[model samples]
Target chain A: DTAVSQTPKYLVTQMGNDKSIKCEQNLGHDTMYWYKQDSKKFLKIMFSYNNKELIINETVPNRFSPKSPDKAHLNLHINSLELGDSAVYFCASSQDVWGVSSYNSPLHFGNGTRLTVT
Target chain B: SQQGEEDPQALSIQEGENATMNCSYKTSINNLQWYRQNSGRGLVHLILIRSNEREKHSGRLRVTLDTSKKSSSLLITASRAADTASYFCATDHLYGNKLVFGAGTILRVKS
Candidate 1:
């Protein structure tokens, strides 16, 4: 079974349209994260949720909002997307929020959702 | 800000040859990890080395961590064509839970 999965593997939209990506993890992890990978293949953290609580917000614009209904699911909604919003969004999960303590628990990533804004 | 910076953004090598990638981080880290991502796929965890540990080995993969230098290296031996992928280093802070990833090194192993 796929431990982590995200919907809408590919998204192509206009410049001003809004869209959402859904992510789910079956690993029973407490920490989930949203990451953005640009064309240059630089992966950057956008948001992180620990057991449905917002823990890290990495200076991302307000246009991008992450909602975690529960510890198993985390969704991202992009509002008024711009041309620069085009990138690959990945969903990842770990055992807990503290990476140091969870020595053997590395992040489990899902196949990314590629979004393109014209 | 991105903490880890990897050397040689791209590399190409023949099958059976070894590939090495180096990563340098700005701050102190509790542990360092290496991940691999193939084309059109998600990142896969390769190995992790703690700050107190100097080196670790997993099958054909070898990882080295130097806390004093705030740097790490990943070495893959007897690489095959299937080993062609982007390798990334992620550093986990001593106090925080987040993992900062480096710009990956793309490896192309020609069989």
Candidate 2:
């Protein structure tokens, strides 16, 4: 089974539209994250939740909000998207927020959702 | 604020050859990790090396961490055509809880 999965592998929407990307992980992880990769392949963190509690918000715009209904699922909802919002969104999970603390803990990522705003 | 920056944004090598990518971070880190992402796919975790350690190996992948220099390198031996992908270096801070990723190095392993 796929460890982590995100819905709508591809999304295309007009500017000012609202959209949501759903993510779920069967890895039984404690922390989940949302990342955005631009055309230059620069990956940036958007939000992070540790056990369903918000732990990190990397100066992301208010229009981009992350919702973690539970520890296993985190969804991103974007409102009034702009041209700059076009990028690939990836969902990732880790056993704990700390990396390599106990036996090389690393982040497991989903295939990613490519969002395009025109 | 980028945590890690990888040099030589892209590299191409023939199969069976070794490929090395370097990463430099600005902050003190608890651990460094390497990930591989094939075209049109999510990234796959490759390996992780703690700040207290200097080197680590897993199959054909070798990772080295230099805490004093705040840099790391990932070397893939006997690279295969299937290894053609973008490799990224991510760092988890010693005091912070977030894992930050670098720009990434695109590797094209030709057959």
Candidate 3:
């Protein structure tokens, strides 16, 4: 099984439409994160969840929300999507709180969901 | 803001040759890591070198971190076509758990 798997590998929707991307990790990690990669390949952090608790939230649009139901899953929902929202979203996980497991914690990332808002 | 900036946005090499890519960061970091992402695939961790460490090696990969210079480099020796992919450098903020990535370097290895 994939260590980290995300659904809807390719998403295409019109502006004003709402969409959601689902992510799950079987690595039994305590920390999960959502990152957005633009066309230029600039990867930016959107949100991070440590053990189902919100730990990091970047300056993203309010229309975007992250929900972590359990330690193993983190999902991202976007409302009133705009053209700028078109980017590849990646799901990732680490063994634990990064600083706590500093040396050995390298992220495991999902293949990524390519979302497009026309 | 993107914490690290990768030089030579793209690289091309032939099999058996060595490929080197460098990354520079703006803030102090606890550790620096290298990752590879193949076309249409997820990123895979390559190696991690702690701030206190200078050099680390794994198989065909070698990573060096110079905290003083706030720079790191990844060297892939005896490169194979299969090693072709986008390589990125990621660093953790010295004080927090936040990990930031750089604009990746696309590596093309020809056989």
Candidate 4:
């Protein structure tokens, strides 16, 4: 079974359209994250949730919002998407949120959602 | 801002050859991790080396971390055609839950 899974592996939408991507982890991890990989393959953290609590929110635009309904799921909702939002979005999870014991707690990532705005 | 920067944005090698990628970060970290991403796919965790460790090995992969220099290197020996993918280095900082990732190094192994 896939430890982490994201729905809508590929998404294409016109500009100004809103979209949402869903992520779920069966690894029983406490922390989940959302990352965006741009055309240049630069991956950047957008948000993180620890046990359904917002833990990390980068300086991403207001259009991007992350919601965790429960410990096992985190979803991303983008409003009025722009052309620059075209990229691959990945969902990842880890057993712990602290880095103290993180050496052994590597992240497990989902296959990713490819979003393209025309 | 990117937490780490990987050298050689792209690398091409023949099968059976060794491929090495270097990563340099700007902050103190508790551990550094290596992840692999195939085209249009989610990343796969490869290995992690703690800040206190200088070197680590797993199967055909070797990872080195230098805390003082804030740098790390990943070596994949006897690369296979299937090994062709983008490799990324990520850092887990001492204070945050987020793992900062570097711009990936794309490796193409020709058979």
Q: Quick one: ranking by DockQ, best first? A: 3, 4, 1, 2
lDDT of 4 by residue, A9-96 (tens): 9999999999999999999999999999888888888998989999789899999999999999999999999999999999999987
Q: Considering only N, C-alpha and C atoms within 3 Å, which residue pairs clash in candidate 4?
A: none
Candidate 3 residues B10-108, lDDT tens each? 999999999999999988888888999999888999998888999999998999998888999999999999999999999887776688889999999
- The candidate scoring highest on DockQ is 3
Candidate 4 ranges with C-alpha deviation above 4 Å: A99-104
Which model, 1 or 2, shows the larger lDDT? 1
Interface C-alpha RMSD after superposing true interface residues, each candidate, one decimal? 2.0, 2.4, 1.6, 1.9
Clashes of each: 0, 0, 0, 0
Q: How many backbone clashes does candidate 3 have?
A: 0
Give the per-residue Cα lDDT of candidate 2 at B77: 97
> Model 4: per-residue lDDT, tens digit, B1-111?
438999889999999999999999987888899999998788899998888899999999999998888899999999999999999999987776678889889999999
lDDT of 1 by residue, B38-93 (tens): 99999999998888899999999999988888889999999999999999999888
Q: Pick the candidate with the highest lDDT.
A: 1
A3-103 in candidate 2: lDDT tens per residue?
Answer: 99999899999999999999999999998999999999888888989889998898899999899989999999999999999999999998876542543
For model 2, residues B1-111, the per-residue Cα lDDT tens digits are 547999779999999999999999988877889999999999999998988899999999999998888999999999999999999999888666677889999999999
Local error of candidate 2 at residue B60 (angstroms)? 0.5
Docking class of 4: medium
